[model samples]
Target: MQKPGADFEDELENSEGAEELYERMSFTVDKGQEPLRIDKFLINRIEGGTRNKLQQAIEKGHVLVNGKAIKSNHKIKPGDEVLVYSETSPESTEIVPEKMELNFVYEDDDIIVINKPAGMVVHPGSGNYNGTVVNGIAWHLQQQSPELTEVALPRFGLVHRIDKNTSGLLVLAKNEKASIGLAAQFAAHTAHRRYIALVWGDFEDSEGTISGHVGRHQRFRKIMDVYPEGDHGKDAVTHYTVLEKFGYVSLVECRLETGRTHQIRVHMKHIGHPLFNDDTYGGDRIVKGTVFTKYKQFVDNCFAICPRHALHAKTLGFIHPTTKKEMFFNSELPEDIQQVIEKWRRYVSAKGIMTEG
Candidate 1:
């Protein structure tokens, strides 16, 4: 017979979606054990777990018995097995709070808004254990709420996140009630988020929308792809308006109706206008410019100036968790993006002059 939790670990290693990151623990009931509610049994067996947290895990289908999912009320019999999984992976090292600088765009009793720069990971994971936004926030919180020192490590109030290469504004809750409230807004798609992207090609229309199901790539798990037939993945929608045209490339503002991993990057690629210099989506090449050596060098220079995807989370809006008041925040483009845009403008002007000559 298979061990109680071994099956779950195997399943998680092969499962899709959020479970991919989960760390699992399993328990086997003794042969002489009496019938007991799974949740009640787990409270005694699992150290430092509350009935409420375990119940929530059960409700989310993270708990299993005898290699099958079970509810909190399920009765465990002698010879039965149990497994529990948490979304976060088990860390070998402790998460120490680093006193890093944070660009606070807005803050109050309930929440804190941060202008995250490119290259800063939102949270600690795998090889990146510190120097993340979460670490900084933990230090800030420890200072603000000295009580937090008594809690567990890696305790963060983050509700949503942006990519490591994508610079932007992000909001995090300071308390559990605030976290729950912010999460509901995100789940309902009521929060407003707008991104500015410099894409490879100009659009015929000034504004448009891209609708597709966004999910992980079939072969490459690291990247996302669009399912046009809606056969797979979750529904994602992005509304874009052309802000400026540079002939070969255009600047556009994209408004997101739904948030998914790499949604903007994948959708833009689907429309044949991958973000300029986006290394992952084939934007690092000269997608729209001439093959001339001079043009190639110019494009290469632009790539060096930006060194990452030309996308910025320019604006964010959501309702305050405590005050229930509407809040909106905006950020200026980083110097690298601004410099690359200027370079494009000059390149376009020189090209026009050559054509006239």
Candidate 2:
């Protein structure tokens, strides 16, 4: 039997919302097949299938035979058709709704554009069950429109996600049709996304492109690694333009040609310019500053000013899924990032004056 966690790795290449939960599997019995209980039959045929899971699906009216919902004891006869609908996994049902304020940038009957704050998780996963954007949206929907809560799983139409520390604009679909429509655009690489990042070093050129394969690190599964040789991982590309130079750090605008997990973070690190104060990509330390105690203290103060990475999803543009119209949204940098930038500006100006004096 296939392993329980087996997945289509190649699908991650073009798919942005890898964690969106919905699955379907179907099978047709052979002409010579003998009668057997549907649950038993499925457990034998489906990879990583368990009788308990099938029973739960059957109880939830997700198991159908010959176009009708069936119980676990329903027998599968020769030439029978069986179908099973599921989420990402049985454990995904644990998502709970919680009341939390959401920053809705744009909202209509079909979609919602949220200006997510830093330190807020986009979805629920290991070590995070409540206090996610999804949970907050779900609760908001339930309170505003209780009828929409009838669905088995309450995702609140989240289509894509930004990192926990990366504050920016994110779009969510209000229904399945809208989700499908928006997902297609993201998969096609037609959606325009721009990010502003403060990296550790100055760029030689005003603009450039970084191309490499991004995938899970073999040694560290929690972080991503760049495969420049194209031997492994999915193809990823980032185009960047230097917006300002601060001797030890540079602020750059990054436009993503392909969205991958940690695409901006991993790509910047690949080029020796990891995002400032990004703990995961080794940006929490002073990568470009001097070795003096004063310099170290200044860098540490900067880190304290911006507790998270100095990256923001500054702009998002995409076609309206239902309206068939162009939609665009922009957001300002969070206060922490802004403060750090100002600090760097003042430090640079002071150093220039000292050198001249």
Candidate 3:
């Protein structure tokens, strides 16, 4: 959501019958407060703001003490200036319909599944103000065929999300009941998800599993790290098997035992075999030599044309939300990724390398 700027005060004053309130706090540590934690002090001083909220504010770099943002758990000394700025929640905007194409895989009264192409955002955001998967679904529902029911625009129930760059089978619910049911399935780790990926490595073993608690890196927001002193992290499990192995590249199938944000990407990176062309996580190894470097230009062009991670959601299965019948859906590889795979195969074959099963 966009942040309110200089006009925030005027807009707040002119808001109809409602006033947004903000409180600024400042403090100086006492003689005995030398060892007090910054967050603790804020909780003690700010009325109605809990330690959790204060910590969130501080970690988000919203808390300034002596004109510097301090860590939530940082110790406070005898003399320190503290400031806190709070704002009202931004007004929610109704998702608008856009004339975008959608590849509908399956649809029922309770749920809908789409073969979401790579580079398509699951929802709307700043850089993507239109042409989102949700926007397409909204538009499609508006032009519902006589075979489908009249569903409301701006109301496709999304249970979870894939990264904007990940192409996959995505499920949406038709109503709140289906949404809640599918959400419960995800929470319970019973929903099945499988992905196909190309990684920059050779694997001696055919299969393996990765299990760990993943959290955002302290220094690099884009990277995830296995945290021993865990914060808002959860245990994630991924089972993978080698499908094919080029001398320097391996095609792998990853099955999620527990889905978390960037689970496959982080787990593969943690295993020292990050996905091919994943610039954010050591993808440089995939384009080292002169031949691969020349090939890399074509790969990069394809990626830009596709504009997404090479990962694809290959399979998804779950029980029907209303009928209780078991359901499953699988998608063939998108043509772009298929072509890349064939090119890699040719490169390996020319070198007399045996492809892995």
Candidate 4:
């Protein structure tokens, strides 16, 4: 379930049936790619696509170029958008609408904002194909209009994404036009997003910015890493303000400048302040605290209170695609985060050395 990348291009394809190939894969021809047969182009991109299977798919109108069915010999040109609307891989393709509970923050014809809980993945992928944000959205759309129940909502429903363990607010586009508008806003850095995180250290400065190039790690291909002085990854910026400082940890507010994958988590780790309980970047342990058994037990209890990364998407802002008006939404810290903060607050202020940002 690794994302398609330069090192490992492991994406979909299978020869189960040409007709079963659903609208699963989307690819934009690179500006530098020379004219090549559509079949050849796809076989190279799809992990297990065979020449015979692709030819069969083309005959059955499973392949589209610029939104039109094409023959296998059709030449692909630069900037041409190719889409495979087949169940090349059922898990990633089939949009099964499993009914599940979700916190609906705001809803309208063209958009919906959801206060997603932690442990719920934003979309279907890898080990989790059901009980995701997408599944819930599908069910909601179906329930809103019974006629549409038989059909799956287009992939445009998700305008942006957050990590599975990161809980917070998310705005989803209900249509293609809205998707385009919102996507442009995110790409241009006009959309605003803020997160609250508890990191494993106290900061000397009240506020600061962390900027670096974020891309796939060379060793751990699944997770992201920082390219501080290299040109291998996308440029990312995260501004953070210390909200409150405990003896061994601090509550921080992060406003993202560029929404790279895991931007806040990566930037915080780059500065040696990984989010507490974030196991991926090594924040699960007591980084700066007493070695005594009592303090260890206290930290362990806090971990149980949250049981996940101590991060939350507190605010999100964007322009309404249809209304042409600025839209903003905020969410209170979830109960897990609130309880942990209060626990630290009581522990820190026992003496008079605690400081607030």
lDDT at residue 195 of model 2 (Cα atoms): 97
lDDT of 2 at 86: 58
Q: CA lDDT, every prediction? A: 0.77, 0.77, 0.68, 0.77
lDDT tens digits, residues 1-357, model 3?
Answer: 222352433222222101112223456667666577888877877779898888877765557778666787787777777667553223226566778778989987778899988777776544455677777887777676534443342332665667666787988877756754565455445788889998877877999998887766667654566654255556778899999987667889999877656778878888888887676677643443345666667556645543445688889988887887888999998877787788778877887989875
* Deviation from native of the Cα of residue 217 in model 3, angstroms: 1.4
Model 1 lDDT per residue over 1-357, tens place: 112343323222221112123335778899988999999999987888899989987875667788666778899998887877654433323456789989999888878999999988776654455788877887887887787654233342655678778999988888756765565566556789999999988778889999998877888766778996558887888999998888888899999987767788889999999999888899999888678998899899999999999989999999997898999999999999999988988878876732110
Error of 3 at 57 (Å): 26
TM-scores vs. true structure, each candidate: 0.74, 0.75, 0.69, 0.76
Q: Candidate 2 on 313-346: residue-level lDDT in tens?
A: 9999999988889999999998998999889889
Steric clash pairs (candidate 3): none
Off by over 4 Å in 2: 1-91, 148-156, 353-357
Better of 2 and 4 by TM-score: 4
